[model samples]
Target: MFKRLAKCIAFANIKGGTGKTTTCINIAGYLAKSGNKVLVVDFDPQANATSGLGIDGTTIEYSMYDAFLNQCQGYDGIPITKIVLETSVENIHLVPSSLNLGVASMLLQGTRDKTGILKRIIEPVKSFYDYILIDVPSDTGLFMLNSLRAAEQIVIPLDPSIFSLEALEYLKTYCRDIEEMSDHVINQITVVLNRAIISNSTQNSSGKPSPSEEIESRLKELPDPVFVVPQSLLIYRSQQEGLPISHYATNTGKIGKAYEAIATHLSGNSNVVTIPEREAEYAS
Candidate 1:
């Protein structure tokens, strides 16, 4: 099982409300469900990953922050049994985040090797999981720099909105800076367009093209995003109940199928490279 493990991946973007947390939790869960031992490191101080996976964020005594502060050398202080918490889905574990992570970020900023702190901390546990998925905060700060440094691949979740497109450009700029500043080489930073509702809303009122068509046209103008996660209310309901969409809406049809497709794509055997664009015509 350990032999099949590959590089850790971080999911990040400079924009909030992009479904970054949702995709992180779902991808980790799906990977674990597919028989890989998955570890999700929740780097967001808001603890969305922790709560999303059914772990009460406030109760976690040892978080990623503690691991960073001690340089992961004092991990022994945490009981072995308590180091990882299982999610509602089998095979998935979470390293909960604490509010103190904000302080940890401040401390990281004071260090010379700011980009490598997370990498150094995760190194000891690298061999234990088949895949490690990091859910980073929305801001492009030292925390994100550490996340990128720790990862070989990055997945950016983008909401299909004008602001999100602008944010993607900003994130790309940040990625360039990180590459210039650190020795880390994130070779696979793929983008995933999320909340892709196929609205038939277009500019021309007379037989206007669909919203999905508009989105598709936009996608055609650039290099493809890795995938487009359709907007499904199932996700919202599941999140409200602290459950992964796959687990909560397992039999709900299209949404469940979409998540399954995402899982399949992540595992490297699917034709997920081409993303279908949505038709969304925004009034400028």
Candidate 2:
């Protein structure tokens, strides 16, 4: 029920080190490799997504900080398009982030229609790409809300942990709040269960389930389908080298294929929200 804005996806979870930024970067890379034009909007103040793609944040001339300040705060600053830069991955581009990004959230305080600022900034460039992937902070703050407001789909990159399970429950409620605030429902939600270890099927003497078994059992209750990403050291190696898993692993190994499977799901209609009027508009 989201308005026909753009193919925006917000990768969110208010939990740090859960592979959210990594998932967003690699998925954007794979989607681009598949011949679709992709733009990565690193809305996270930490700028992890920007550096993860081999783009140095310190050397960037323009960043998301400028876009929010200019577009939202009524200053005559550069357009969002001016901030978009070509990334190391082909067919993929980026609106890089900077350390100053956190300041935008504070500056926009008390402004009218603040949550919709990102939506309006992105609305002008909808036709330029097949998808726009936004990586927001791991906190339920103004930045997170703004990105979620602009997204049509939500991708939760969850690590298998008790704390992560609690975060997912909180995220479900947060998404509903976003729908109410944005005046449209988030059409699709997909969960990527990162770093999954499925070998622990045996139970203890007391019959208590293994951690993996318990997590899987809990995951089954969620309405959305879950994709499992196994625990791999190559993931860390790829990140250290500032490369996407597909590029580093050449889409051959287990970890690489797992992410590729996720890329496959995201490439299909099942991962994207169907908006009738938008399709009609595109048809014309």
Q: Give the Cα error of residue 271 in candidate 2, in Å.
A: 10
Model 2 lDDT-worst window of ten? 273-282
What lDDT tens digits, residue by residue, belong to model 1 across residues 46-92?
98988988888767768877777765332333432356677777878
Pairs of colliding residues, candidate 2: none
Q: Kindly state the number of residue pairs that clash in model 2.
A: 0
Model 1: what TM-score? 0.85
